[model samples]
Every structure is written in structure tokens, then in C-alpha cells.
Target: MEDHTAGHNKEKRYECDVCGKAWQQPYLLKIHRRVHTGERPYVCSICDKSFMRTQELKKHRRLHSGEKPYGCSTCGKRFARLSGLWVHRPVHSSERPYTCSDCGKGFKLSTDLKVHRRLHTGERPYTCSDCGKGFTRSTSLLEHRHTHTGERPYTCSQCGEGYIRAKSLRAHQRTHTGERPFICAKCGKSYTRSTSLREHQCTHTGECPYTCAQCGKGFTRSTRLLSHQRVHTGDRPVPSTVCGGGLAMASHVLSHQRVHTSGQPYDCPYCGEAFDSSRELRQHRRAHAGEQMLPLQQTFQEHAGAAGAPADTHQRVTL
Candidate 1:
């Protein structure tokens, strides 16, 4: 009765020194301290797994026993915990009580609405300790930590290829199954992933959402825009291992390396002609297709004109 009175009166007498968490009961405070001390008093006899609380141990035991005590009244779905039933209850109903003020988005759960609000607020509460990278969600931050640890928990059974995320593994498995689930409504083209389908849809819309600040050049993808910006910035992030020469792109490094070894790796199937790089090979293939190939200077002049820049604006005679 005293415990009930204390809880009803909103009185928390027991407080932890470490985290300053108040509890109505002394025993509850003792259990809370175990979280800071890393002490697990309750042990599962079957699995030998330890838990901070006895209730957690009881929940863990249900996994081995295959016991689900909680049941939904709507769909008759069984759950091991009461919290799971509470979370599942909303799925049966079309009602969304929790609404976001900013985006006018509705969510069934308040916790989900709170996370969605962070997107509008630009609030990244979760941060990485390794590289100091910030993430909007805790799950995203947890996935980012796997990069530093080099852990790929989700693996493909057929090909033995590992991925950091389960979604990536599922997407890669489609390659083996030949499943293209995501289809474009415009062209009726299919893709393994939804992101690829969205990118392809941009071609039909002719929406160049990503634009370069320097040249005013537009691109369908953000990666293409970033690559175009590097041309203006002269940001040679990739360096040649052979000659230590700075190259604008990582793909260009292979061609630059061939200059030192005099290796013509790319070969034309039509004329049996070998080239140092894939770019030259592609140009060689255009000739075989009877396509009029423009000279290097003329091509550069046309590109400069499209970019609203003079032909001699970036000309440099390398000695």
C-alpha cells in the first residue's frame, strides 16, 4: 500500500548517483544501477545468457520455450512481450493519432512521429564516436559503426557475399534470382532496387535536379554533379601509384597508370586494335560503327561552348 501510495503521489525517493535516475522503490534503483555497472544478476539456465533484470531473463526464456503470452484482440497475433502487442495494435486500425506539425505527416506511434520530426528539425542526436559522423537515427548510426569494425553480419548463402545491411543482401540476392521487382511506370523498365527505378524515372521527366555551381551544368544524379564539379575545382583526389600524377577521377587512374607501363590492355573486337585506355577503345569502336568521330580539339571546343566558357579558358600546354 505504501509502494502504491508513493507511485500514485509521484514520489521518487530512491535516486542513482551515476545517471541521476529516480525510482519510487529502493529495489528498482538497485536494478537501474546494474546498467551503469555492467552487472547481470539474472542468468538464463538454458542458454547461460545474462540479463540485468529478472523480467528480461523471463522474456529471453520465452525464445527457447516458444511461448507467446501476449495476444492481439484485433488480428489474434501473438507476441512474447506486451510492448510488441501494443506496437502491433495500430496496424489493425487506420487511425493515426500522432501527426507531424511541419510536414503534415501522420504516424501511428508517438515514437515514430518523434523520429520523423527530427528530419524537419535537422536534429542528428546520434553521432559516431569513431569518425565524428552524425546520423538522424540511432539505427543509421549503428549501421555506420559496422564500417569501422569491418563487420558484415548479413551474408548471401548462395554466393557467400557479405553486406553490412540486410537490405543490401536482399538486393544482391535478386541478381541470383533474376528478380526486377521495381518497375518504372513510364518506360515499363524494371530494376532490382527502388532507388535505381527512381533514377531511371528522371530521364522521362528530364529533371536535372543536381546542378553545378561553376558551369551551371545539370545532372540527373548527385554523383554525376560531384564529378562535374571536380572538373572546375581541379580536385584530383585520386593519385597514380606509378607516376605519382594527380588524376581527377578514380576511373582515370587506370588509364594514367598504363602510360608508365606502355600496356595497351583495352582491345577492339572489330579491328583487333589495342588501346591503352577504355575511352580510346570506345572511340575506336565508334569508327567501326561508321559514326563520325570529332577531333580532340573540336570536341573540347563544343564542350566549352555548352558550358558557357571560352575554348581557351582551361587550355594548358603540358611540357
Candidate 2:
């Protein structure tokens, strides 16, 4: 059995003169004594940054060297420190021990639990030193600092993919793994993450919650509406993907070619007949099943009313 320090050493001993408190370990007491003396012995070679503890200085140096020695054996995800890998491993394992007191949202790490607590408390302590923008956590402030510094140190070895944060890098690595954890309970549509799955679910429900102020068009996902709004604002995309075909939305690239094609690749499972568009295929399936068509003009009018847009503002056909 391991020695029980609390049971054996109950008597007060090794007291700090500054705080009038005792310590279990003399090494811890010695380290605590440095606060009174204002001594930071451990120094970095790259930036000459100093830390009270040697371990803290060692971790700080890894930020400069881009060294992630600790790696997950299962997912091949890497971390600068073992503690970070410890926190990250649970995501792969789907182990959520920590939960929110307010909403009962489960999280793997205690740090995530603390960050989630801010939703209940509304406590923002970490304010940006440069811009005075407030964040609930110190990690958020650190990420916000990257915006000012424009530092994206994390670069992928495979495809030279870059990210501002380590967590984003981890998520980007999943693209190679083909691991889609989030699945739609209703449609069986799979996504790499829960957020994407939620957005995909909205398409089936016909729920376009985000409204564009300029065109008065509503989108199911906020990201979609944000991208659509860019069309008006003259925000051209950086062209991540290349194609010979001229298309607007990346999602419509495969579907839009039906205007010229003789063979319809998309087929109605109910009738086994091919259709030009997926929407047409859906309508065809409904027709075979003896379902009445919702009045297209009336549906467009309802959608326009919901988006706070005039029906004549944009030439939109309801499918």
C-alpha cells in the first residue's frame, strides 16, 4: 500500500514564514518561498522569458519550437504537453465526466467545465490587453491575441494546412481519418462534428433561422447566410477548391449539371426513375405516393413573410 501522508504526518510542520502555512513536501515549500523573494530562476533561451517553475518554462519553449512530442496512439493526434493529450484523449473515447450545472452539457475536461460555467455566471475575467475585448477564459484571450499578432504557427505536415489554435489543428487532422462521429438520428446523415450535423438537420426540417438584412433572405445555417451575404458585400472567396465548371455554391456543384445531362444520376427510390434535380426527384417520389403538392407560390409567400422580405425582392421558387 502507498504511504498515507495525511494520516502519518498530522502535525503541523515545514511552515512558510510569509504565509504562516505548512507544506506536505519540502520541495513544494521551497518553490512557494520564491514568491516572497521575487525570484524566477528558470529562463527561456529563445525569448529570454522567465518562469518561477522549471516545468512552466519548458512548456513555454515548446510554443516557440513547435514541438508536440506527446501523441495519441489511437488517433495520431499530437500535443505539446501530456496534460493536453490527457484532456483530448477523452474526445476520441467519448468519455464525458464533467457536466455543466446550469444546462447539464457534458465535457471531458475540468477546464471545459469551467469555460462552460461562464454561460451561467456571465463572468468574463480575461480582457484583451491590446483591444480591451473581454473573454470568459484565459485561453480565449490567448487565441484573441493571435488575431492581433497574426501568428498561425501550427502547420500540417501532410497538406500544409494551417490553423490559429491547436484544437482547430486537431479537428483538421480528422479530415484524414474519415471519422464522422456525429450522425443524424432522423435521416442517418453523418457529419464529422456535431455542429455540422445540426446544420444538416435544419435542411430536412426546412428551418432557416438566420436572416440576411441586405437581401432579406433566410438560411438554415448562419454560416450559409454569412456566405450568401458576402455575395452582396463583394467578398470573394479565396478559391480553396478548383473546378472547370462555373458554380456559385460548392454544394450545388454536382447537382447543377443536370441542366445539360441526359442521364439523371439522382433517382427516386420509390419509383426508380431518374430526375434532373434532387428536388424534382423528391417531388416525383411524392407524386407516386399520392401526396398532394404544397402550393409553390403560397409556400414562397410564407417563406418571404418569415424572412421579413417582400416576395418580389428576389426571384425564388419554392420546391
Candidate 3:
């Protein structure tokens, strides 16, 4: 009779019924069957988290042990599993295989495509238990929970300002470093944020995707759409502390606060009077230059869906 437990050089006898992938052992083929059956047989003793395969459970246990054995040959970056190293390969190759059907954007991984699809669908699956606010990803919801808990894990090295997310801290650092990486293709204006650059591009294309349902007025920013809707609804939720005047967007509240700060650097060349933002300065300068105010630069959101930030709040603009 043949030696039943010879060695690793055994013949590939077991074949998967779904994909036709062959393995050396019967138990290995049974574990592979979980790909089709959605079976998680291996359970972690520490967290009780189930995994489809024993190897997967072993890799996941590294989360508790803080062990990352797989190291990238190129960058020396560590990962818990070999599959992570496989996914990291595309980062060096500049290869993006996954494409979004809605926007025709490319991503390196299918998981990224899944997240990007939510932007088009407006589907926020991850929700905050505290406020019932929805987020596209769990990471966003995790960062948002910091507003309630008063947690600032990411801190700036220069000015020591704390942020809940690393991305926010990176963006805030740009204010000090003057790192405007995102450049407008049309106007040559650079912005620290890609969203700001895209918003600037809309001026060249005149593409206002956001439109008011009541008045049919087109706006480039979603914040402006929220502000415009208040006119129809007659809602004034955000109130100014200096005056009893209602504010629509957080930008209005900031601009109103400037009336009290008295340290405005943006002074009019024509009148020597100061204003808070460039938009206000330009509007004031237009009067002296005998030029009509364009009413441009509409997007003004102070805090987007934050605890203290004005969300769905209307400001009563007194004419």
C-alpha cells in the first residue's frame, strides 16, 4: 500500500467544485469550499471573531499580538498577512484594476471601489449610535464620535492643535507648511484640499450639480444648496451670539464674528477698511473699483455635520 502521510510533495488530489482549484489535502479543499458557502469555521478564543480558514484566524490573531511578519521587499513596510503584501504590490506598479461605473474613476482595490460607490448612491451604511448620524465608512463614524467624546488623538507638531483624524491634522498642517499640492488645471490656483480645487474647477466648467428644488437656482456646493433651501422652508436654526440675527451657514457665523475680532488683515486697497475673508475683501473692494460684485465663491461651510457645526441650519439674510 502507498504511504498515506508521505510529505508535502503529495499529489494534488482534491479539486474545488466551484473554481476548479486543486489542493494537496482533503481538509484544505474543505476549507477552500467556504469561499462559495460563506462558512466561518475557525473562531478566535480572545475576541470570538470567526474566520473562514485556519490561516485567516491565525493572521487575525496578530491584531491582538501586534505581530506583522510579512514585510515588503521594496519599502520594508510590514503587514499581518501575505495577502496584504499582495495588495501592496499594485502601489509600486501604479496599476489600478478596479473602476467605478458611475464616475469612471479608477482604484487599486475593489474595497476602495465599494467605498467610492457610496458617493454616487448617497448610501451611508455606518451609523453613529450616539447621534444617529450616518457615515459612508466606519473610519468616518469613528472620527465623528470624537466630537462627543472630546478626543483629539492626532496633534499638530507645529502649533499643537489637536484633530480627531490624521487626515484633518495633515490638512491643518498645510496652513503652516503652505503645502498646496492640489492645483487647479484652469486657473493655476493651488489648494491644500482636493475638494477645494474641484470646487474651483466648477467656475471654469460652470457645472453646478447642486440645484435648489424650490427656486431652480444652481450652486456648485452642497452647503449653498442647504442655505438656499432655508429660504423656502423659513428656517433659522443657527443664531449669532453678538446679535440675535440668524445665520445660514457656519461661514456667516464666522464672518459675523469678524465684526467683533478687530484683527482683519484683508484691508481694502481703495478704502483701508478691513474684512475677514478674501470674498468679503473683494466685495468691499468692488464698490471702490466701480465694479459690480460677482456674487461668486458660494461654498461656505464652517463645520460639516459636526456637533457644534451648523447642520441643516438656515440664516435669515436681512435685505
lDDT of each: 0.68, 0.63, 0.67
User: Model 2 misses residue 174 by how many Å?
Assistant: 10
- Taking the tens digit of each residue's C-alpha lDDT, what string does model 1 give over 81-117? 9999989999878899999998687899999999878
Tens digits of per-residue lDDT, candidate 2, 161-259, equal: 666777667667779888777799998888876668877887788666677776555566544675565444433322112112223233332233332
The best candidate by lDDT is: 1
lDDT per residue (tens digit) for residues 99-166 in model 3? 99987879998998998888789899999898687788899788878755767898999988777778
Model 3: colliding residue pairs: 247-315, 248-315
Tell me each candidate's TM-score: 0.47, 0.47, 0.48
Error of 1 at 153 (Å): 1.1
Off by over 4 Å in 1: 1-39, 45-48, 61-80, 170-319
Winner of 1 and 3 under TM-score: 3
Relative to the true structure, candidate 3 reaches a TM of: 0.48
Model 3 misplaced regions, further than 4 Å:
1-108, 119-122, 214-319
